[model samples]
Target: MSTIVVDHLSKIYPVAVKEAGFKGTLTHFFKRTYRQVKAVQDVSFQIESGEVVGFLGANGAGKTTALKMLTGLIHPTSGRVEVAGHIPFQRRSTFLSKVTLVMGQKQQLIWDLPALDSFKINGAVYGISDRALNHRVGELSEMLSLQGKLTQPVRKLSLGERMKAELLAALLHEPNVLFLDEPTLGLDVNAQVAVREFLREYNQRYGATVLLTSHYMADITALCKRVLMIHQGQLIYDGSLDRLVDRFSPCREVKVEFARPYSAHELSVYGDLQDVEKQSARFLVQQEGLTGAIAKILADLQVVDLTVSDPPIEEVIGQLFQAGTVAG
Candidate 1:
């Protein structure tokens, strides 16, 4: 069964006219004009249970707005949204209790209190049994390495530490569905990797359905096998991450490692060299040309090793966005 189903969902905000100053405000109180801004327009998709899907779009593309609708933080202007067999906008306690939304830029933990206290508060709100709460907290804390930091005030914890704490709080009730928006934002490289690893492990262990939205391609690449791309509130693509790459990614990048240093003129006969070093050169080759490119390079030089791979996910997404903007 599908964990989430969205049908022709749309969200529109009324833009209120703001006066320049006090005098202007008084003059325009009776003559204000309102503009309609459509944030999400006719977007629809379905996510199967236990599927890890990436929701991708550039800024102002309505990713966060859609997430809010799915989590019952906000109601949709029109259309339907169903999460875990319940209408999310209804804000039913049963549905809310089974889902969690985590935003990296937002904090649910009190700054002055320890994360443990915040977790306890959430536990109370969810009506978790004391014994189960403790066990769940212990498991999540151990998984996220929050052993010592849970007792520290949130303000005293580092960005990464606090993020881990937030994850613990969100998962304390063992939510079956998760909506993560930029959950690794502002985290250092190691911290980002740690969060990514934890998410992967958690998904595997519990078979939870997750929909993640992030500007960081690494987050999507590592956590999602399927990706949905939206542009200007329109669904543009939805399929395997590999297929997204195959359809939009420029081409495979061929890196040939040389046994010895070679000049550029010697490599140009093969393909467009993207980067070069004394003993290695990277080339951009079309999918059809990859094998031939490798063959020609080996036939021409003392090549030690060769590697071929799809263009980076970021580049693929950039191209997708660029095409979208141009089409608009």
Candidate 2:
């Protein structure tokens, strides 16, 4: 079953227009001019129950705006959205209880209070019984590896610990749908890995549906098999992560470490030479020609080692955004 559905979803905002002059300011004060900014335009997609999908976009690409509409934080200017069989903007009690939105840049915990206190407050708000709340907190904290840290004031915990605590609190109600925005933002490498592991485990254990948005490609690569790419507030691509890569980047990077030095010109015969440093060189070779190119290189050149890999996901997505258009 589809846990979330959106059709032709869009949000537009009006911004007051003013010129850089006293006359313009005086006129704006009495009769203002405004321009419509299309933050999101005709975006549509569906996420099945228990699916983890990545929402990809550059800054100001309406990723957050779309999330807000899906979470009942803001009403969309047009189209339709249903999460867990409920209209999100309605903000019904049953709907709210079935979904959770966690933004890394925002905190719901009281800074001066221990996170456990905040959890209790959230429990009260959700009408969870004392025993059930305690059980849920204990289970979630253990999964998050947040043992014994909830007693400290929120401000005293490390950023990673606090992020984990936030996850625990958010999951206390066991929402069936999770909308996470950069849950690993500002986390160190180890912390990022930890959070990713926790999320994977939680999803598996609860069969929760997750729609995650992050600037960190690692988060997307680690957690999502399918991704939706939004450029200029429009969804440009939606499919498996591997398909997205194959579509945008039809070539693989082949790094060859030679037994002897080779000039860039000499390496160009094998493929598109990317760079050469001492005895090693990198080339971008079309996937169709990869096997033939490797055979010729080995047969003609003194090669010590070679490795082939897809272009980094970040680079591929970056290029896609730069082009600003993808064939539908």
Candidate 3:
């Protein structure tokens, strides 16, 4: 069953008009101008219970705005948002109790106190029973390898350790719906992998529905089977991660190394040459022509090595944004 439903959800911010000159600034006090910037526009998607979904977008693409709406941190200008059978913006205690949002740049822990104290405070806020809280805390600390670090003040721990503590605090109540925005943004590769593994385990153990927004392709590619991609405040695509790649990227990349420098004429014989160097060339060919193009290139030239691959997800998304801008 769908645990989250968003129907035409939209958010708009009114931009204040400010003039540069002194006279213009004085006049603005009497009559001010406002422009409406639509941050999220007519976006709709359904997420089932226990599904881990990725949210992809460029900066100013409204990924964070949409997440805020879902988590009730901000209200949408229009459209319905139901998460876990409750309207999020209401900020109902029961609804809030069952959902958690973890942002990488933001800290909910107390800097002056030990992380364990922060968790204790959160446990109180959620009104978790002492027995239940202890059990949950123990499990999370073990999972995040924070047993010893729990006694350290948040300011004293490393970035990665603080992140783990944040996760543990957020999960103390075992919220059924999780919203993670750039959860591993500044961490090194090892830390990133650790966070990813924890998320995977947390989801499997609790059957929580997770919505993740990240710039790192590896984060989305490793953790999510489905992706919701947006651009310029509009929903661009919603489907399987593989389907997203397939739909937006119909052309395949072909890299060919030659024994000698190749002419444009010979390259054109294979496919559209995307780039060329002294001894090698790369081409973008439609899926249908890939096999024949490779065969012809191998038969005609001294082929040293060749590789074919789908375009990067970031590139596909960039193309989508370009197309949207042109359409508008």
TM-score of each: 0.81, 0.85, 0.85
For candidate 1, list the clashing residue pairs, or say none.
Answer: none
Residue lDDT tens for model 3, 1-328: 7999999999999987888999889878888899999999999999999999999888899999999999998989999999999999899999999999999999999998999888888989999988898899889889988789988888999999999999999999889999999999899999999999999999999899999998888999999999888888998788888877776677888998988998887688788787789998988888988899889988989999999998677766676767664221
Candidate 1, residues 1-328: lDDT per residue as tens digits? 9999999999999887777998778766867788888989998899999999999999988899999999998989999999999999789999989999999999999999999899999999999989999999999988998898988899999999999999999999899999999999999999999999999999999999999998889999899999888888888887888877766765788888999998888788789777789899988787777788788788879989988887677866886887884221
What are the runs in model 2 whose C-alpha is more than 4 Å off? 16-33, 256-308
User: What C-alpha lDDT does candidate 1 achieve relative to the native structure?
Assistant: 0.89
Please report the candidate that would top TM-score against the real structure. Answer: 3
- Sorted by TM-score (best first), the order is 3, 2, 1
Higher-TM-score candidate of 2 and 3 = 3
Q: In model 2, which range of ten residues has the least summed lDDT?
A: 319-328
Q: What is the C-alpha RMSD of each candidate to the true structure, in Å?
A: 5.0, 3.9, 3.7
For model 2, name the residue pairs that clash.
none
Best by the lDDT measure: 2
